[model samples]
Target chain A: MTSEHAPIIEMRNIEKHFGSVIALAGVSVDVFPGECHCLLGDNGAGKSTFIKTMSGVHKPTAGEIMFEGKPMHFADPRDAISAGIATVHQHLAMIPLMSVSRNFFMGNEPVKKVGPLKLFDHDYANNVTMEEMRKMGINLRGPDQAVGTLSGGERQTVAIARAVHFGAKVLILDEPTSALGVRQTANVLATIDKVRKQGIAVVFITHNVRHALAVGDRFTVLNRGKTLGTAQRGQITPEELQDMMAGGQEMVALEGSLGGTV
Target chain B: MTDTAQTPEQDERVKEISSFRKALIRPELGGICGTVIVFLFFAIFAGNSGMFNSQGVLNWSTVSAQFMIIAVGACLLMIAGEFDLSVGSMIGFAGMMIAIFSVSLGWPVWLAIILAFLICMSIGALNGYIVIKTGLPSFIVTLAFLFILRGFTIFIPQQLENRTIIGGIADAAEGDWLAPLFGGQVGGWFFEFLGERGLIEVFERGTRAGEPVVDGIPMLIIWALVLVAFGHFLLTRTQFGNWIFAAGGDAEAARNSGVPVNAVKIKMFIMTAFCATVFATCQVMEFGSAAADRGILKEFEAIIAVVIGGALLTGGYGSVIGAALGALIFGVVQQGLFFTGVESSLFRVFLGVILLLAVILNTYIRRLITGER
Candidate 1:
């Protein structure tokens, strides 16, 4: 993709903190349409912090977020959603006991009128959610199945389908496959691919290097409150990416300094 | 995971009711079982002399009606993830308001009942307002209301020259205008203790086996059934009920999902108050008297009914039908104990057992339901 393609969502100079601990600092990333932008980091490397900032679960201490090239500040998660931003958290923000239809259209439930009486139209919600899931090649039981009965990968697929159904332009996924087994992780990655093909920009946050390499078009690494860098597919290899994210050079310097002191 | 290859249609049906078998172990189901146990004990211990007696059934129904009415609204509040401790005192206050107005001020009974209902509803609304505006724990707010209502009941009677009983409300079966206003007398057989408010009749049935069944059933039972049915329909069929469940399930999630949690909560609080008002009306009108002591510990009974009905104290899961059955279970215990020759004073111990048992059963059911997935 060239600079000619306007990014769907762009964050500039984002900063966040919790008391005296700086969670993120001056992190910048852009998500282009039909592209997978992976935000990579090790534990405590500000990846979760970045996702929260983007999802409006937490406001940046200082930064500008541009959606469709328009400046805005989201007051809360709902605001972000209305602006066509949605998230599939690692924890899977869905009621497991509720039916798949309920979980999929939870925030945006469908309703119909019967002789001026407003009623919950289960049929519509069911068909639409099930159809959307089916379109994504996610086969399962009927829409009325309890979400809790689904596999981790299937639930993630439902979450992605939900975000897409809600008209999300910039989808942010926080380690969607982190809890899945090997084959399940592959299934979720396939979902990420399907999501991108729908022309929605995706911010894929993950610690798994192989998974990211398989799906990511642009990669941004976060290390201790700052952006290490953003690179195109050709700009970095999977091994080099792993080394940088793991603090390969930084660890060497720290070890040298400690050794000199001893 | 079923052994059968489910067609889409069959799968749809199964998905819709995959939890059908699980209901057998639900908390309310256990309460239903307990009701059977208590009834069997009564039948065996006292036989027709106690278990199948006409007066016995009427006695239990009357007592349980209070909890059923109050618990219906409490169930709504609980579904919205809140509580109301002031219902008992609200009952007293409502009764007193009618007594003071109809007796001392010489106001008509009809006006007094209307005024009493309105006042109760207003207080309920006020409680809701305070809860939402401050975002405080509803437990404390309702407890405070309980104390406030109790205080007024105690202090106001003495100031009014002990004339809290007017036109036959104090002494049961006095001809207070309230009696006929609720339901008229039936051929030599009227609940005269509340007095003839005006001989109004709400239910009637043909003689069964040549028994004239005067008005046949308690007006309170009919009302409870109506309200319970209405409440059940609302929870299962309406958007508002959906909102209540969502709100209780997770307030933050609901808010993000576009539910008006604060406004809905306030509305639920008021609904509870309105229910309390209805119970007070029935009790006062039936006995043709209204006074401060009319409502006592009834609020706790309502909450207990809710919990026993399968509602979680921690909020966000239960049914209105469950609450109604819970009240029935409670009714059985209270009335059945009389047949079992248990001391009325030990009712608290019996209730404690039910409470503990309901909690244990509820936890297990919840685990079973959620963990199965």
Candidate 2:
């Protein structure tokens, strides 16, 4: 779904450094509501660095982040979560042995009954987690199942589902489909589309250009800790976009001599 | 379609493994089995010669009750992954205090009991507080307390004796007020089951057709039941119960979930000491004696009961029911070996073997189900 909407999250001149190594240097990006804004880059192009800035895992050295146009600094990941921003990292932050319902309500669980004889609202937790999963276009088994038994793609889907159910306004996925096969990738991308339909702003951070092109509303390219270009859908062809991502003309020739190893 | 990543059969297999794994880690099965084996052995062997009458039953059960009560508390500590070796000394200290107040000071039984309970709870609180503040393992904290407390109880009593202190613990057991409760079979209560209440059956079959119904059931059994039920409720039902499980299961995860891990652990350490205090109170109340030499190595018995009860030494998994059963198993073994003409030294060796075997079984079953990360 495409919308003529105002931007939800806008990062201006974000700069981050780890001692001497510049992970993210003066990178700026925007995420709009009801849009899957793909943040694409190669291994060292600062894709991870940029997402960490949005996620509150890394505070920018110099720049500022604006959520709904109000500048904010996140103190921790918990603060990031409460600020309608959540990241589903590569490790899929979950206790593998814990039940799906328990993991869904890990940090924030609903309490039930009287004190000294109180009980965990397991039924409500299961129902809510299941409902969220269904809304994400994923048909899962009972929430009692251990998440460790689920497929890698399914696990990632559940993580995304969790972020959405917990009222995340800006969903930041860090390479969600990189290790999955084609069908699983399709399933994940479909799940992403489901999130976009809810009118939440989704930052689909990835390196796979085709995956980005498939579901992204806007594409931003980062290279060597600097923003190469930011383009709306259909503004630049995939080939032109690839050339920019490779660092313009000089790098194009260098890539040609390197036999397109990238 | 040509290369499917997952097979449906494999998925089912994983599900089965997880379901089975949940059962294997319950932490009660070991204790129950041990109880049954020990009970049958005693019943079969302790036939005609020994004091296996109704009064005898009450006496043994009352003795087991102290272990039961303490083991229930120790079970909680073990589930949180810690141990206290000073429980024996704690018991001595508390009992001595009770004797001092009830006999030496000529105070009433109820007042003395209340004061003693408070003193014991305070000792427990102190032990727990010290361990948490120092970040020392409970083994060291409790072990140090044990000998220090033992010396305190004995040295104080000897000094009082030297000073010719009046009424120095002579009348502590003279009255029938509180002693009858811990004594069992003479105004004692065990547990209500189905419709009938279960109490100790005491008699010599030579004169009596059935087991003699004794007066005043063991108050220790009543107290032990309260401890067991309370433990079961705390471990399985309440949010703190859930926190307890989580803390023992994985402390980091529990902390991340805002479980108040440090506070819960400190409380657990104190609770163990508190239970030791209660057990010691019952001991002196039953016997009318509170010497320093008593309660030695009682910590080992509590630990043994917990182990036999099927609690994992690693923490985060056990049941109070299992611990009670574990106590029963110990009681049966202690009495049964005498009937079978087994030497006491040999009996201990047998216990060690059973302990080793049971733990092995527990670990093997655990591996079979969880299948490792």
Candidate 3:
């Protein structure tokens, strides 16, 4: 568990609510540098709400988030970004009509000042985008090509590379491989591995146990807005992880009853 | 990853196609070709009527200049994913403001011009604010302003002067240092030299005897060119321009990517308003008067020009240069019809047909480039 190294981010008893609805309750997790921490859950299991709180999309109703062993509170996603925590959302947050370089450096654009004018440093942006993407194993045709022409997996890789290049200490990916094809899923998983090797902590959220087993060093399962438990990679088997994610005996009994009626 | 990667061989093959052919497939290519075809069509049919002469060129260039000014603004706004239907009415309103302030209220022409810009830009900011705050389509919000401003253009003038027409703008603006910059022709000496050398026609019957009719380039054309260049640079070379494309392409995505989508869109609206005011300033100065009905249906003309320039009506893809060419095509067809001795009203039919054809061609080319099925 690398007890010698302090965890980069630690959450204690995190809780979130939307009006009368309890979206999450007492979900706690930890992310360490150079580790892929997979968060597994079923539909409506509050996995999204938990990550939203961690990434500053939503404020937790009651909890303590410690970043680098210091209590942290983010007012919004921008604050998280400034704090070196980057989240690549499920939609990937990409403008399809924009060029690769533009999308890559969107908010953190590089500029070249000429007298009184600050112009987008096209050559620098294009070169850095191409180089960073190449490091992620994506050989772009050119930085000026529209992102719409890229595959879903390539777009995800671009988002990951952008986060890494921007010096993110913790990269949170929300279902990065859910909509991808089999090969695309592998490509994205490989990109996550590459990101981890760069010493950035990755919070990989997914419902797919196989994908988690492939890249996860630790797994945290959530059910009905509460964390079931956390397990190290070698400590838990995929089948056990799958059952825990599906609610174990409760899910089996429901299936048995449904199968009998059918 | 290997499957997704483009091999160097394939990359080389992609480079094999000439950049010219690549350029030919761009959205603006249609506008360039359309401009050429339209220009040649008019030149061949209206050759005997001076359609190709300096006099005819100056006449159409003046009209094209006005449209180009607003079209560039419209093109930028459309790229930023919003519409300002109030631009036409904004012209009338801004013109009235200038006339009321300068001619009626006896303010300095420069002060009045600045005041008019401030007021128009405020209205534009309000338009953007309401659209963003209420989450309503800008089309609806600006459509309401279109009527509201048009009504005010008349009502305010009537309230102040007891008439809808505000006159003496030229007299009031006379002797002001800024007047010539916004109003007068620029290349008169050069044109006169050409006329003296018998290289260009010198009108024998109009104005002073044997004076060159074309004179210098109109201020409107100069302003239009400057704006086009500025708009092109802003859209292609600046981070703000990149934000504009992101804002229009997907507002949520742009926001998530840390782009100030709201700010970009609001600025686009303000720019459109500013352009409308510029148009009003030029027209009022050149005509020496302001009318409540000035710039009627000009919003449609600007949108048409933008669309013909290869911008999508839906937003996110366009160019200022293309828009300038679109305005030129419009000007040629409009003046060419006059030179051909055809009824000017037929210009509307031509506009409609050209818009339809250009949109169709643009869609086809976009499909080819994007490989959209």
Best by TM-score: 3
lDDT of 1 by residue, B1-373 (tens): 1112112333332343355664475546756755676667677876766456555777788777767989999998998889999999998888777777777677777777789888888899899899888888989999999999978876776688565444455444246555453433333344332224433322244543223323346666767877888788777667777777767766765665556778788888888888888787777777766666767888888988988888877666787888987898788788777777878877778878877887677777766554442
Worst 10 residues of 2 chain A by lDDT: A90-99
In order, candidate lDDTs are: 0.77, 0.73, 0.88
Which pairs, if any, clash in model 3? none
Q: Residue B296, candidate 3: how far off, in angstroms?
A: 1.9
lDDT string for model 2 (A13-103, tens) is 9999999999888998888888989988878899887887888778899888999889988986677888889788765455454557766
Q: Candidate 1, chain A: TM-score? A: 0.92
RMSD of each: 6.8, 6.8, 2.9
Superposed Cα deviation of residue B229, candidate 1 (Å): 1.6
Worst 10 residues of 3 chain A by lDDT: A253-262
Q: Quote the true-contact fraction of every model.
A: 0.21, 0.11, 0.42
For candidate 3, write residues B1-373 as lDDT tens digits. Answer: 3334332434333445467876687878768888988888887889889877898888999999999999998999999999999999999999999999998999999999999999999999999999999999999999999999999999998999999998999999889987777798898999999999999988878557677878899899999999999999999999899988888888877777778888899999999999999999999999989999999999999999999998878787788888998998888888889999888899889878888888889888766554345
The native-contact fraction of candidate 3 is: 0.42
Interface RMSD of 2: 5.8
Sequence-dependent TM-score of model 3: 0.94
